[model samples]
Target: MADEIKIQEIVEFLLKHGDGYDADEAREAAKQSIEEGQPVVETMCLQMLAEHVLARIHDPSWIISRANEPDCEDSELLKRLLDSGASAADLALFARMSQREYLSNLGCILDGAGLYDTPSLPHEEFRIFAVNDEDQPTAMIDELHESLGFSGLETEMELSRQAERDSDNAGS
Candidate 1:
């Protein structure tokens, strides 16, 4: 199929780049992975290629700059979630965080799988949201303070809540 040929081509190109792999070895590995029905070999080939690419990232700015592109925006699903479920106070907590805190928060969020050895993902239709397993939002927020060093976030969330309560009472 076209996909198989494309993958073999990528493997050949990466191996030819002298990452301790020769063109002949790439051909043999690619053949086994494609013609011999050993798909896992292709996975190894791609992982080897990824390692070489990741090792070349000498500057964090390269990643930061690319992340600013519109392609990196939260998908339409998340935009809707914020519109419907998220509150002004929630947005305030995020908007007020320092740059360091923002990146730290993103790192913590991205690596959140650390707590689970094997996490069950939802169906594609529900993939935009975390699979809710009967957890309250407040409890999960509290847990993040301990798990991700988000004590400052926890405090900010509290202040936001109190201010909202004050405004509500004043409006009455």
Candidate 2:
């Protein structure tokens, strides 16, 4: 019961302040929650860490500074950049050319990179039904992704497909 309360408090805190809170602050909060016996808090902390890393990766100035460091090996820098959402082409350009040249060619590199095909993750969507009028059998079917503030259209389609499969299996 105590653990449940702590988890609920953590969830409420995240829902209330997640957007406004920096990754470090969120991480600290998650840590405190963990120390309070909330094992699930680690998941939130990991998410915050990923967000912090991605934010750093997306900052152009940070990327430039890291790229310009002479002591840093190109492979190490490339790996970090990739993990942060840098395209493979960008890393290739960075490896082979001077920073100035790389910057000058960035647009072209991106355009050319777009020509290569890449596999995308499959989308899944799920819905929750809230029945407001039981007599009329009317329900509000909320897409799971939308309720979670996710970009839901693709996920909804995927989930709908999965639900169909599950229903078919159940019928069989």
Candidate 3:
């Protein structure tokens, strides 16, 4: 019963994506889905395509997309905070709030608003994640950190040097 539904969904997705519904591929996916006991809706067609079709797509965009997706479990709360006009500090504070009701309700509202951009984090706290399953590729949260002006000591020194040079030029 479910296998049929899985086949239908897979076929529909493939068709929508212009795959033209090949029997061989559909059969294989269906077989794998049944063997894995995964719902038809859970078939990993997109993963296969990422591995095969758009293999050239860079790690950063892929990681950023995953980080931005509201449906993802790991960053779902952070995503909600961004949507709610909450800064990174707000998110961290919310995470500490004792009341679950307030947090959950606000999360739903933020999720419904469709805002999925990342929130600001400190420069020293900037995080990097391996966007994909493999650990070799990494994407950093530089923009959010830089936008917050959380520069490191080295960066501050460089800026100081540039400022001194500009002052000398102005005096001359």
Model 1: per-residue Cα lDDT over 3-76, one tens digit each: 57755775666576535767677766666666654555544654566445444444344333443445644334
lDDT of 2 by residue, 1-172 (tens): 7755665567666756466755566566655766764544444565565446444444345445556666654435445776899866565455435534433343233223322333342322111232244322246435633554635446756898998998899999
| Per-residue error (Å), model 2, residue 95 | 12
Q: Model 2: clashing residue pairs?
A: 125-155, 125-159
What TM-score, to 2 decimals, does candidate 1 have?
0.24
Q: Sort all candidates by TM-score, best to worst.
A: 2, 1, 3
lDDT of 1 at 160: 85
RMSD, candidate 1, Å: 16.3
| Global Cα lDDT for candidate 2 | 0.52
Instruction: Score residue 17 of candidate 2 by CA lDDT.
Output: 48
